[model samples]
Target: MKTGNQDSSAVKAPDAARAAGTDYERIFHPRRVAVAGVSPGGGVGFGTRYLTSLQAIGFEGEILPVNPKGGEIAGLSIFKNVEDIPGELDLIVIAVAAEAVLPILEAGRKKGAAGAVIITSGFRELGTSEGIGREDEVRRIAASGIRVIGPNCFGIYCPKSGLTFFPNPDLSRESGPVAFLSQSGGLASDFMMTGMWMGLRFSKVVSFGNGADLREAELLRYLADDPETGVIAMYVEGVRDGSEFLDALKAAAAKKPVVILKGGLSSAGGRAVVSHTASLGGSRVIWESVLRQAGAVQVRDLQEMAQACLAFSLLPERVYRGLSFTGGGGALGIAACDAAETFGLEVPPLGTDARGRVEALLPKSGASGVNPVDVANPYAPPALLEKIFRAVAGDSRIDLQILIVLTHHFKGLAQDQGKTIEEVFPYRELADRMKAVAVETDKPVVFVLPNAKRGFPDMDVVEIHAKVREAFLERGLPVFDEIGDAMRAIGHVNRCYGKGETS
Candidate 1:
């Protein structure tokens, strides 16, 4: 396990990640970064959105605005050009029009720029020789081995580095092990916010457009060395360099997990990919093989990617010996069966002695006291819940326990404006009971609630989603959107603790 770099103590800041062979901090956590086309108008120029986005997200390092006809963009003074700038440039994110990109890059090269993310589009996507010629020129400039993120990309956002491009994410105070990189700029920014809204922590979010200089493979290699990142998620419309991608993905898998959602699978999706990125849209079978070989999980949807991230994040460093999942409805148990089967998780039925032990403690009518146990009563006592969990999860064979609490009455619990809290559907009692059970069990427990959100249809005054999230965190268990996420966590725990070893 982890044979790539021996010194685990020195993982804080690895020097190899700063070199041409594998360094990504030069692009993501740059010391001196330049925004090549910041505008003069306060918030009216084409680039104002980016300038304001950067400041809004709170980039920590110096953000130099290099504009020939610039005075101020958001009250920040601008320099005339990169030539006039004085210092070592770690990264450059160019936001100028298509025609202005290469020229600004030339200026950036002269200033000792280590890398550049070209946010300008309209080059290779135009399907013209001139566009292709423009791409060639981009590669030529990048020949100095200065890493480039995109010619038509949204750029990267590192919460730890204060590096954000246009369409800056709604950064979260919570930072976790997941890192996301996508070839689709639109998807990257939108997904970042979506993940935040869904209670997910993001490590780094990048949109590597066009990949004229540095492709997905190089970036994968770079993220592998990042200490802050643990789970890697990616969305790809096209691939620029296959060999490099394979190498980087292999290295990354050796370090952590990489989950990907490819835009090209079916014939229709292939056409979409060809149109979106000018990619050739190679055979899907080959792509699948490559993914399996690289040890990356190819998730089906954005929701699945998020779920996979949570699964990979909550998993224990060691493997799990077994799993225990309890559902309120029989249909939910069937769904859990499918989830466990698909994820390669064991769902062994409880033995006569184990079932008898649970039945002895739990309310007779409330729980079936069986594996994939379905408690029949809807308003089952929370005390009964605490008791059953203590008995079933206490069994030494189980390592993870997942509780599915379907609560929609919380929306029904809404009180009229200025009304007292007592006249509401009491969902907290159940949540508290669940938390107590989880803490008592001493096993990692994931909670899933069906059909609840920030502001349900009944009330504009109260946000139930926010309240429940707060409640769960206060109880030391994080609330997930679906049982798929819960099971994924279980699977990851088993992977980590089982006899699996990486070469």
Candidate 2:
């Protein structure tokens, strides 16, 4: 795979980025990373897991440790201050206690550091006198033309160079098109972990923590031009410049989809809205109008937003409007229909002609015969599964079909091995046959596997399922984690790109 361009040739920063494009370049794409108050714990808190994650991926950038503890972390020397580092530092990570950040910032500035990522949490969030003092010190230094990432935040990442501190205990760094920016470090970490299942690699991910200097809007604009980024997935705790944000969104949307998981949106995205953009459109009216006007997709949470973007960036060429489902749950079927409807789909009732094919496929007792062809009863078989789907061969309503696999024998699979034929995932041949039906019929098909709690198989088996979806997607079919995601994708495709088979 072609990695994104690492354009180090300094360009002029937008008037928005403090009129210094060089600053955004140095801040966003760092060559050297420094950790203050580094930990050795294997836990997410701070430890060897972090260093291990970096080294495991073979980060190319330089890493320096600034800890008063004076102990070696990950077998590397831990210096007490940022100035103590050997060469010119591109980024400084402040993980010490909040009160200890100011001195570090001063030291970094004096040393001519390009940027500092403040990972300490107490300040600003706790709203104490000390927190206020910490905030004041950070602002004072940032004012001197040195960029600061957070005073109450976790960290940031440039995966292309292996400078991620957003915490990935497992999963490799070279994963997909996503360039994520968030206010919560935990989400950034977990989103990457979960996203890995679907090949959702990231170009770079940033935890703007408290947004002391490099605010969300500024970061979004920087990513808009970053060649490594294809889709901009943002978790907005707050947007500082509303007009600037709208301008940035409009500009970026022209090239890629801007999927927003706008936090604090209940108060119409309360803290995230008020703190970030200072521009309020009265929650209901303003945001809705803007979203439509901008043609940006707005998702509910971080997972939804990330997954949606992953699908968007990786999708082949077109979005199919056809939908066919073969699952065991009535609620999922109903929910799929309802959600897809909102996305501008025509979920017509399963036709009588199609019902005949389903009946012939698995006997009268085996199929739902209607829209979400519930094909997996205890008596499901390879022949029965294909026959039921053959019913929708003529339905012209939607372009994609969904199969919901209901294998609740997951716990049993744990006792088995990765290659256990009796395990639910070992049914890849059957799944392949289903995929083949879509291929032969020249239709788009997606599958949904329910009963995840039943623990049917190992992650490799799960990977098998993901691979099936990926294949279906690669062949112009849209697959989703939930039937709803598939349905949502279908609707989005029809509206923006037109009704056609999309891989």
Candidate 3:
């Protein structure tokens, strides 16, 4: 996974290395990591968190904890310093105080560390003279051949390498085709967690705060050619070199879809940006124009970003004519039509052949035969739903088909039948049908539970939702909570990649 030519001989600042092309390949695939400033007792200190996170993520690489106290933590012997480590260090995590960062980095460099993730704050964001001077010193040290991720940030998460800032046992370790770079550490975690819930997995994620080193443009260029990454998402505030950033963004977008969510668009947000990462908040209009010209999709929130990434990762690489959906109630179908039109998506009526087939499979009492086909009682047999799925997906007029389930009503139907929802709904069979339809058709097939609720106190409902959603996700089908969000996400991807006639 060589990103580019490695000019390791030329010692240049990360920002100035645009011409030199510093290889960030080693940063994401390190074999041996040393965590400095780990304290005893294994409290939630940043250093301890990194150590535990690596262990919890089942990192196979050698982990060496460093502290001057020379004590054992979690039964691992703590080295007094990185220099005391037995072998070359591929990466080091620095969580010491502001004044203590340089010496640790220097020692790590002496121990042949290729990269360092500085999780310590109190640098330039402090707005103090000493802090500014310290940050400058960091830049100078960064010029000495060692790549850096942050001076005030959460580091990185590479599930393949089992490297994480914070690890969850239940999080998917299987690598997917999405990569994310964020300026805010908190936003990075939020995007990962939310994306996971939405059935989106990432190839790699970086929280590069302050951008003292490892500029966003360099990371963007690296991901552009990365074999594992098919979709790139970014949360940014500003860039140091506007022209270079634009060029890299354009290059990346030309190869794969790029979704950006720019923070600090508002005046108040701008002020917060300066204090948060010491970034310059560019004007919204200029940023929008630049993004549009670069052929990048600019999203407003994490939800939009996640959904757009999912669409790019899952949808077929073909032009879509319009979108259509089935199931749910008539009112929900009406809402879907409204939302689709609002997002510049068309809800054109299904072609006669497809409509005839769907209507035949559905009951005559309350079924909708047109575009947003309403199946009033969605508790019908799995075969009938699959027939409708195949008919709509194979239709010439419709490009994308959404299967809508009003979950509450489905559960009610199960109760009325004196059985559990799983017994009545046949989630496993439906998931198998959806997967089969997706693979057989060139058109995209998506499942939607428009009224899906989160954090339900009823464990039964929660378990059912998890089981169904997980089934779809495991088979490479995306599930959404609302029709509007699903369409909006698909619409953004369509517009960016020159897909549909409308959106």
Q: In terms of lDDT, which candidate is strongest? A: 3
- lDDT at 225 for candidate 2? 84
Evaluate residue 69 in candidate 2 and report its C-alpha lDDT on the 0 to 100 scale.
Answer: 61
Task: Sort the predicted structures by lDDT, highest score first.
Answer: 3, 1, 2
TM-score of 2: 0.72
Which is better, 1 or 2, measured by TM-score? 1
C-alpha RMSD for every candidate: 7.0, 8.2, 5.8
Candidate 1, residues 390-415, lDDT tens digits: the string is 77776777777767765554333334
27-107 per-residue lDDT for model 3 (tens digits): 788898999988976677878877887887788888899998878887799998778899798899999878899999988
Screening candidate 3 with a backbone cut-off below 3 angstroms (N, C-alpha, C), the clashing residue pairs are none
Clashes of 2: 32
Ranking by TM-score: 3, 1, 2
lDDT of 2 by residue, 1-503 (tens): 12124231222234344645346566666677777767644234453445566677677767777676666777688786677777777777776666677888888777767788777788777788877777877877887868888866656676666766645535466645788888888888877776665457678788888887777767777788888888888887566655566767777777676777766654343443444444454575566567656656777765677557656665544656556666655676778778777776656676777766665665455457677766546335666667666668677664666777654453355446554424544355555676677777767556655536424435644554555555544443444667666666555544445522432
Candidate 3 local Cα displacement, residue 494, angstroms: 0.7
- Between the candidate structures 2 and 3, which one is better when assessed by TM-score? 3
Worst window of 10 by summed lDDT in candidate 2:
1-10
